[model samples]
Target: MANPTFWVAVALFIFIGLLYYYGVPGNVGKQLDSRGKRIADELAEAKRLREDAEKLLKEFEAKRAAAEREAAEIVSNAKEEAERLASEAQEKMADFVKRRTASAEAKIAQAEAQASAEVRAAAVDAAIKASESVLRQEITGNAASSLVSQGLNDVRAKLQ
Candidate 1:
């Protein structure tokens, strides 16, 4: 009210003088340097931690890849073993079938030979009966005597 401009100027001068006396370039530079160093250290620590994390990730990836490859190899080996077993089983079955067929064929041939021998024996018996009947009807005494003598000689030769 009385001289407002004068009081205003005095207050401005006091404020500036305090800044000059106590502020290191106004002390702000020293304060900011300390804070900046703290911030830089924090950034470096964060960078180190990030690098460690990246290395761990790479190791895990490599391990995972190796495990997958091992699993694939195991599967391949199992498949091959199964196939080999199947092939061996098939071969054994084929051999068994062949042996069975041969045995059946041999049995059939033996049966045929036995049947043929029986048939020959039956025919010979029938022929002997017929011959005996004819001889009984036609033989006279002298002729029968001559036949009997020849039969005795043949029997003796067969015995020798």
Candidate 2:
């Protein structure tokens, strides 16, 4: 009954009972409930932010895919256009070559005709000169004397 430990325990019991009678425990329970609700709200907000970030990433991915598709189409169209232009150029070049060949052939034919005409005229002149030279060689001294005597007899008859 005289121990100091016994007195301290009795004082602690009195303090605990007074605290319960005044509804202090109920106040502590209310504070704890409010703290738990705040923590739950913060966790829910964090989940919502994470979901928004995932949606944004998906949207960016879709945009990137569309851009890649568009680029492929443009490249395909460019290649097709280049091929068409090359084909058109080839046809035009072939036509130009054909026209040039025909023109050259026509020129060669005309030149050949002109050269043949010139050769034929030169052959005719050479033949005429050869015939004149042959005739001079055949008429000799006897043919010259007979022409002179015939002319003198004709003059004497006219005088008689």
Best-fitting candidate, measured by TM-score?
Answer: 1
lDDT of model 1, residue 46: 98
Using all chains and alpha carbons, the TM-scores for the candidates as numbered come to: 0.61, 0.56
| 1-160: candidate 1 lDDT, tens digit per residue | 5699988888888888878877646468877898899999999999999999999999999999999999999999999999999999999999999999999999999999888877866665565556655765677687785785575456445543
Provide the lowest-lDDT 10-residue window in model 2: 151-160
Global lDDT for candidate 1? 0.81
With a 3 Å backbone cut-off (N, CA, C), the pairs that clash in candidate 2 are: none
Candidate 2 residue-wise lDDT, 57-156, digit = tens? 9998999999999999999999999999999999999999999999999889988888876776565445444644554465557774565446445543
**Global local distance difference test of model 2:** 0.79
lDDT winner: 1
Error of 2 at 79 (Å): 1.8
